[model samples]
Target: MKIHKEGFGTIITSTIIAAAIIVPTVLLVMPLYPVLGWITVIAILGLLVFILSFFRIPGRQHADGEDLIVSPCDGTVVVMEEVEADEYFKDRRLQLSIFMSPLNVHVNRNPVSGEVTYSQYHKGKYLVAWHPKSSTENERHSVVYKSGDKEVLVKQIAGALAKRIVNYLKPGDKVKQSEEMGFIKFGSRVDLLLPIGTKIEVQMNQKVKGGVTVLAKW
Candidate 1:
């Protein structure tokens, strides 16, 4: 699979950590394998953690169309309901939330082929990603996309464990349904607020693939 460009730093840092643990264990502790076998096991597990955390999977492909809607991130659907977007842009919308566990790929993808009309990052507190209050209260980057007449909002939110929220795309940038937009560090979430009458394809607690699953359609 292709490693995402946004995950380069994560991969590099993980590699360095693995090297530090393995080389030192083999060179300095290999001679003590009989007595320090547990130490060797610890080193092996450390390498495994880094490998899993930094790994990225290529997004699944789908046919393109004007009415097509794509999943915004690779994670499990945590919230799916009609709710009011009360904070930045106050309006009633279909809120479909995806919870990004640390094990899942943290890269956020554009939900549709659109021209970004508005994009801005808000500095705020790190709240639990799944918390209902987190949607409007947590640190996040908001992106409004215009695909023809459709306007949808995607928010990259920081969880309690995630301190850094990386958004690479800016306002006015054209984005494709399958293109990468940003990566959230550690555990986080992505919320897509859609207009009324948008078909809800997925339900709460369901798993969804970025760019592969259709969450809504105009």
Candidate 2:
């Protein structure tokens, strides 16, 4: 597995902090209370490991097809329902949401190959990922991809623990299916607004991998 580019700064900062704390404990505290010093070392090291693991990009072949809509992030599906469109479309749509925990991979991928027709960021409240209002009220970046006659909107939403949402696409940019679109720092959720009548392949509460699992078909 390769570490993502987004983690470099964070990893460096964490390494510095760990060394600062570990060095003093080892020199001054370890000689007095060996057990406590060892515990401190272990705890700091474990936390550093978790930070590294959060940005890991595992090696795997991604799914791709013209009519297939792949999952944009690794998480468990928390919602699959038909709801009235509120933002861009202003019509009915099938909304599918995946909830990503702090332990889950945070990389977001493009679900289809097409030109980006809309890319907008919204500033809002940070609600818990599973809350019904979080989809609209939470901080988010929305992107719409137009492939032929179909257009799909994908939203990267920030949860209570997530503070940064990174998106790399803009209107008029061409994107391919399963390509990296952004990264969400920490825990969050992703919402896909699909055109009504789209065939759904995944079920509620199902686990999915970014760029690997087939979510639906055009």
Evaluated with lDDT, which candidate comes out highest? 2
What would the per-residue lDDT of candidate 2 be over residues 133-218, giving only the tens digit for each residue?
99999999999999989999999999999999999999999999999999999999999999999999999889999999999999
Residue-wise C-alpha lDDT for candidate 1, range 1-218, written one tens digit per residue? 66666667766777677677777777777676745755775767776665555557654665466787888778899888889776455778888889998878777778889899888898888889999888888999999989998799999999998888888788889888867788888889998889889988787888888777888778
User: Where does model 2 exceed 4 Å of error?
Assistant: none
Error of 1 at 47 (Å): 3.7
Q: Could you estimate the TM-score for every candidate?
A: 0.88, 0.99
| lDDT on C-alpha atoms for all candidate structures | 0.81, 0.97
Residue 214 of model 2 has an lDDT of 99
For candidate 2, the per-residue lDDT at 84 reads 94
- How many residue pairs in model 2 have overlapping backbones? 0
Whole-model lDDT for model 1 versus the true structure? Answer: 0.81
